[model samples]
Target: MNKYGRQSGPRYSASTNSAKAPATQQCQKCLEFGHYTYECKAERVYKARPTRTQQLKKPLKRVEVEVPEEFLPKREGLAAKILKDKEAERKKNKDKKKKRSRRRYSTACTHMQAELRYFIAVVVQQWKQQEQQEQQRIFTQLLFRILALSLRLSFSFAFALLLEVVVRIPFSLLLEISVALSLVQKQEQKCEQR
Candidate 1:
């Protein structure tokens, strides 16, 4: 059995064309309850219904009338008044332009001042860099001069030590001192090269 086809209950047969029961008001024609005035079996009164007014798609054309010159509105001084207003506006615009020029000059001066500060900063930075390079060069020269002086002193001292060993000490000790001096000189040379 299909559930949607029919339910297991009593069926109802409703008529779409059947008239509905009237309201519980007495009819004006028959003075009866549950009946409308129009459905009464009496002389039917015919009353005219108010009809709706239709609006025109296009409006009616306007009629033009000729107006006399002296009786019409005056426009004699309109151009003069407009010219005066325009002159006043032009004066105001001129004043505004002068103010704008002054403002532009002030802003330009401020921009130039900023650029000048930046230029001075760059110059100072370059000067510092040059000074640092010069200091580094002077230090390197001083270090080289000191290294050469130390090598000369070491050679003269080794010669003096070798002479003292040969004159007052053993030959074996002299040989050891000479060998150590040669090694020291070679190491100093390497350091100088670096």
Candidate 2:
């Protein structure tokens, strides 16, 4: 038979209802009702107990348990300040980039203007050169015409002198001879094969 026998010991019932009776009986050490053996205050309370001779003869054993490091919470004000600083720095860098690009744009504009000025100068110089060439051609043509007229005039004057002063011929006849000579020269130049 069990130590708490069926007939002479505390009765063991199959009831699970807590309102009728507590789950666990009175503690064996404190005689208090409710709760279980592991959760009992009497079990948790430490008391001075006799040390066994086997424990006294052995050296004390040290137990090593690993504990993780605890994380400290960040200060809200400091975190906000750091975020603001980062945003300000980002804005400043963006503005600096804008300024740099603006400067580059201005420099490029100046460079383009200089190129335009140089292009205009080149065009003007070319125009001036063409005008000068045209003027030079016209002047040379005029000079050639003047020289030819002067040569013809000089020949006529020489012929007149030969007839009137040396040969003592009439002026009207000499004039007629000079006119015929000029007409013959013009016809010969016109009819000559290229």
Candidate 3:
């Protein structure tokens, strides 16, 4: 301890001075570290980047393979003929599917047509029923009117005839007694009595 009551070691320690490194500047033109583009005095350093094609490419490793020819491969049924037969079978399956689709479509059309026909028939039946009901109502109204007219006409005729008979009985007798020449006369001509 010093007389100032301060205990001290190396004040400027090497660790304290070397705590951080100097910040580096990169050159924009050369893309190299350690110097800015404006302060760069050395030649521009170019990074070696491998040239790549615009599209993706892969290296093909090929090796020459020697094959011994088999004479049995020249038979009638080759791999190509088998592939052709498989393609023909696929075409036949496709045709069968098309036929099934056609049959389903036709059945659907028939069903729709049947439904339409049934709907039309129902509509027609309803229309006919309504028409018949309307006709029946009109006929009943006409019949009722006819019956009422006939009853009214009969009542008017009976009342008029009774009044005539009652009025002419006395008058006819008086007239026959006064005249004493003519036979009995019928009712009034103005009333159209026949």
Estimated TM-score for each candidate: 0.25, 0.27, 0.27
Tens digits of per-residue lDDT for model 1, 1-194: 25788755334344632354457767786566776665577665566644444235445578999899989977759788999999999999999998997677567646644553443344344444654656444433432333333343344443443343244333554565456567658755764453
Name model 1 segments beyond 4 Å from true.
1-78, 131-194
lDDT of each: 0.53, 0.50, 0.47
The prediction achieving the highest lDDT against the true structure is 1
In model 1, state the lDDT of residue 24.
78
C-alpha RMSD (angstroms) for model 1: 33.2
Query: 14-91 in candidate 3: lDDT tens per residue?
Result: 677444423586677776676556555677677775456522365446797876677335655688899999999999
Rank ordering of all candidates by lDDT, starting from the highest? 1, 2, 3
Model 2 RMSD, rounded to 1 decimal: 32.9
lDDT winner between candidates 1 and 3: 1
Q: What is the lDDT, from 0 to 100, of the residue 140 in candidate 1?
A: 38
Where in model 2 is the C-alpha error above 4 Å?
1-76, 131-194
Superposition error at 149 for model 3 (Å): 54
RMSD of each: 33.2, 32.9, 34.7
For candidate 1, list the clashing residue pairs, or say none.
none
